[model samples]
Target: MRIIFAGTPAFAVPSLRAAHAHGEVAAVYTQPDRPAGRGRGLQASPVKLEAVARGIPVLQPESLRRRSAQQALRDLAPDLMIVVAYGLILPQAVLDIPQYGCWNVHASLLPRWRGAAPIQRAIEAGDAETGVCLMQMEAGLDTGPVLLARATPIGAGETGGQLHDRLAELGAAVLADGLGLLRAGIRPVARPQPEQGATYAHKLDKAEARLDWSQPADALARKVRAFDPWPVAEAVVAGERLRIHGAVAVEEMHGAEPGTLLRAGREGLDVACGRGVLRLRVIQREGGKAITAADFLNARRDLVRA
Candidate 1:
């Protein structure tokens, strides 16, 4: 089968490898290179780099909505199209060109967390478990019938980056299973997502990373986990802004106002929340590397409780 793989970012790299291993990857479609890093030099997408390394043709069109772009994809004569975290939207014209239609490797279970930033949203929502779904592409955003799926539990202390890496591998494994079935001339059955329990995961904004101490400590802790390793949760603690890399909710009764520094000890920096206390384990100051709570306490002797 001639496969056309479309994806961007590191999360899609594993799936791209799986598709290439399964069948003939005629070409790869990814967003155009964009300026990145402090120097702002052009950086190619991870999928594009991998495709080039494998001697596969790479297509980086601004949009597939254009007739010329759709025609170019049609010219590839691909038997199937596999999309994983591909930034561009696929039009109906492009979807119809493939013989087996387009298959999307989404990071979350169907009808739940369906949209951009599913991985982060799942963590932020304090979900107990999240998984990947291989879905048949449609015009709507992530509203597709699932062809294959794999579920995994969300660890209590897992950060967004950790879950992302695990889900990326799981997605590749699920896609490989579907591709194996196809290679044996068997088509996987598509199951339409149920209307109930559908939640849209809007893209992550830097503004949401600001930790609100007035909210429940558990919620703030979840946000810290979810945002760790783009925005890293930020909050003003003792009149100084710090990025929270690791935190946990403590069920301690506190009369102090929210965001008040309750204690600083070898364990962690405990701050009063609306309902509980938040113990920050790892933190980083502006233009500094992440440090443990002990190190942070040592640096700020003033925060140590008498």
Candidate 2:
């Protein structure tokens, strides 16, 4: 079988590699290099870097809607196309080029979370479990029919970064197996996504990083975990910016006003929320590195409620 792979970012690299193992990978498509880093040098996407290193042909088209771009893809004469985290939307003409059709490895189960940022949204929503799905593509959003799926429990203390890495690996395995079945001339039957319980996983926003003490402590803790590794959860205290890295929610019979510092000691900086207490275990002041709550309190003696 000949396959054309389209993807970008680190999450997509594993799937690209797995796709290579099944058959001849005709070509790879990834987003164009963009300016990055302190010096603002052009940086190739992770998938592009990997594809080049493996000697696979690479394409970085700005748009596939153009007939020329679609013609270039049709020239590949691939049996199937595998897409994972490919930032671009495939026009219907391109989706029709491959015999087996385009398939996507989505981060969440079908019909549940069907958009960008599924991993973060799942943790933020406090979902008990989440999984990956292999779906046959259609024009509608992530409304494709699912051909295969693998479920996993979301750990209570899991962060978005952790779940992202785990799901990437799981998606690779599932994709490889799916391709194996295809090679054996078995056309996997795909089931249509359920119409009910459908929800969109909106892209993460910077505003969501700001901690709202008025909300429950548990919710705040989840935000800290969900926003990790990007726009880290933050708080404003005494006109100073603080990045909150770790915290725990505790039941409080009677807590102080929201955002009030109730105690500052080795146990952690216990802050009062609307209905519970939040023990901030790790924190970093603006222009400073992360430090334990107790250590930060030691240096800023004024933070103690004395």
Candidate 3:
């Protein structure tokens, strides 16, 4: 099969590499380079750099809705188009170009998380389990028919970053399996998703990262995990923004008002919440480096806010 691989982020790199190794990847389509970091240097996406290293033809189309871009993709004569985190919607016209049609490697099971930011949304919702789905492409937003899926349990204390890496590997494996089934003349069955239990995974925003200590300790703990490694859960202390990276809910400790400092001890900074205490384990102060809670406490001995 002459495959056209489309994706942009690091999570999509695995599937792109897998397809290039197992199938005939004629061209790679990724988002165009963007300015990154303090220096604002233009940086190619991870998938783009990887595809180029292997000498694959790369396409950085700003919009596939344009006729020229769609024609360019059709020109590749791709038997199948594999898309993973491409960061753009595919119009119906482009979906019809490939002989075998287009297939998408989505991070979450269909219908449950149909929009962008599925992985982070699953964690934010405190879902017990989430999985990857390989679906036949369509015009709607992740409204495609499912071809293959593999389930995995979401650990009790798992962070978004941790689940992301696991799902990436699972997605690659399922993508390979899906291609094999299609090649072997196996017709995939598409099941319409149930109307109930559907949720949208909205893209993460900096505003949502602000910590609300008024909420229960358990919920706050989960928020820290869900937003970790991006828009980290934060709060202002002494007029300084503090990023909370690691914490656990202490059900036994209860009393003071939410957001109050119950104690600043060697073990951990025990912060009061609505229902219980949150033991801050790791934190990063604004303009400072991330460090253990103990180190932060040691550096500022009179920091306890009673």
Using TM-score as the measure, name the better of candidate 1 and candidate 2: 1
In terms of TM-score, how similar is model 1 to the real structure? Answer: 0.99
TM-score of each: 0.99, 0.97, 0.96
Instruction: List, residue by residue over 95-128, the lDDT tens digit for candidate 3.
Output: 9999989989999987798888898888877889
Computed on alpha carbons, the lDDT of every model, listed in order, comes to 0.94, 0.91, 0.87
lDDT of 2 by residue, 1-306 (tens): 889999998999999989999999999999999999999999999999999999999999999999999999999998999999999999999899999999999999879989999999999999999999999999999999999999999999998999999999999999988998998988888999999999999999998899998999999888888888777899976457899888889888563679887777887877788879888898898889988988887887887773
Which residue pairs of candidate 1 clash? none
- For model 2, name the residue pairs that clash: none
Q: Which candidate model has the greater TM-score, 1 or 3?
A: 1
Error of 2 at 257 (Å): 1.8
lDDT of 1 by residue, 1-306 (tens): 999999999999999999989999999999999999999999998889999999999999999999999989988999999999999989898889999999999999989999999999999999999999999999999999999999999999999999999999999999999999999999999999998999999999999999888899999999999998887899999888999999999999978889898888888989999989999999999889999989987888988872
Q: Indicate the TM-score of model 2.
A: 0.97
- RMSD in angstroms, candidate 3? 1.5
